[model samples]
Target: MAKRDWNRRTCAKRGHTTYAPSEPELRERLHVATAAGEAWRCLRCGDFALGAPHGGGPAAEAPPVLRGKALRDLFVLRLLAVERGLRGVLGVLAAWAVWKFSNSQDALHQLFDQDLTVFKPVADHFHWDLEHASVVDTIRKTFDYKHSTLVYVAGGVLAYSLIEAVEGVGLWLGRRWAEYLAVVATAAFLPLEGYELHEHASAVKIATTVVNVLAVLWILLSKRLFGLRGGVEAFEAERHSASLLEVEQAARAVPAADQAAV
Candidate 1:
């Protein structure tokens, strides 16, 4: 039997006799049957094999890799974790500031009460004046934090900071419980945020409130919290169905009848 030149182009455009493989010939040669209207091109010359005898062999194509919702979920989780981490840091700073002020209350009061003459030389060296009564008043008002109040405030801030840190870690690890915790913690503060806005509205306060609200809503809805929107099963199914492998398989199967007809 003569050896068939599989690499040669069989299309008229390539100055060769047009040839297309029959179903059995294609299956024997390429190990896969070609569908009707599916043109096979020569691997070497990039020409279509004419007629039903042959066309193009399957190109060396890799299946699409699917990340789908998994990728999206990871991105969202990381973003939330970063936000929580930042909040945790701020809480820690606030707690530290309170504790420091509480311990140095006496020293700060004495410093404020002392005459400007005591620090005149240092102030002059730094090209600054320390003769303002308002500055002393401000310091006095700021340091008016009672020892008991400072202790309580610092304790609360420390606790809050720990919670934020835990939440951040859990979120970064993509824990489902962390999503719930975040939603509850954020929602619990909404009322306080509203009250703050009512008392003294500022751009920062408004922006913070809006961001928290959006984050809470996004987690609740997107994560399908509390069985919303067909629940976990549906969500998982959607993710699985949207996978690249599943999609590609579905696409490949569409021409099954056509291939059979050939």
Candidate 2:
């Protein structure tokens, strides 16, 4: 099996971002004459692309194109963003359901009673109790809650949903603040998730708890949040070093004629 080339895959998908550096050494190293035409090395995937450069500037002004682990991290963050967005959507639906139920409690309860009778025959066939089943009993108990309490519950769910949506948008855009928010928010919920898992050891509960735990750790440690792993300064230094390495590697492959021109 071939290892994935995230840099090249991203370049291929998004198109290469060729750059002409104003620095004498970098300019010479990246500029090349090919059979097709004059070409410049892409700052992103390090591939030589034929054409006029997309942009030209000092080395420091070159666009910060993601590559290697940075590109991989972007993928991970986007995936997490999608997950968060989905959870937010589900939460909103749950809140709406709760709110609607609170408003039509009596009618819904009557309808549920009818539905119970409809399902009673099937339950008898399976030797199960229709109304006494844990899930059914839980639903029945919700009907006993006060309207104000249900409204409060719905508001809480809506608030949580909005928070998740905000996290999704920020994470999708790769904001540092969003990473911090996600780490903090998810960490804060771990105890609740753990409590739920302890109360009901279902596969869904266990999986949710595990994913949240991993996500919190992954973001906090990988992102160096709250001064972990040498803090944000070291985190930034690593990325800067990676960028410099890309330039150096591209410079290393300069043709003799190009090298001589410098």
lDDT of each: 0.69, 0.87
Give the per-residue lDDT digits (tens) of candidate 2, residues 50-138: 89999887877888877788888889999999999998999999999999999999999999999999989999999997768999999
Full-model lDDT, candidate 1? 0.69
Looking at model 1, residue 252 earns an lDDT score of: 61
Query: Candidate 1: which stretches are off by over 4 Å?
Result: 1-66, 114-139, 244-262
What shift in Å separates residue 153 of candidate 2 from its native position after superposition? 1.0
Each candidate's clash count: 10, 0
Clashing pairs in 2: none
Per-residue lDDT tens digits of candidate 1, residues 1-262? 9754433422222443222334343333323334645344332333454344333333213232224355466668889899899999999999999899899999977776675568878988987766565775577777787898998999999999989999999999887889899999889989999999999899999999998899999888888888988878776677667543344345666688689989
Error of 2 at 215 (Å): 1.5
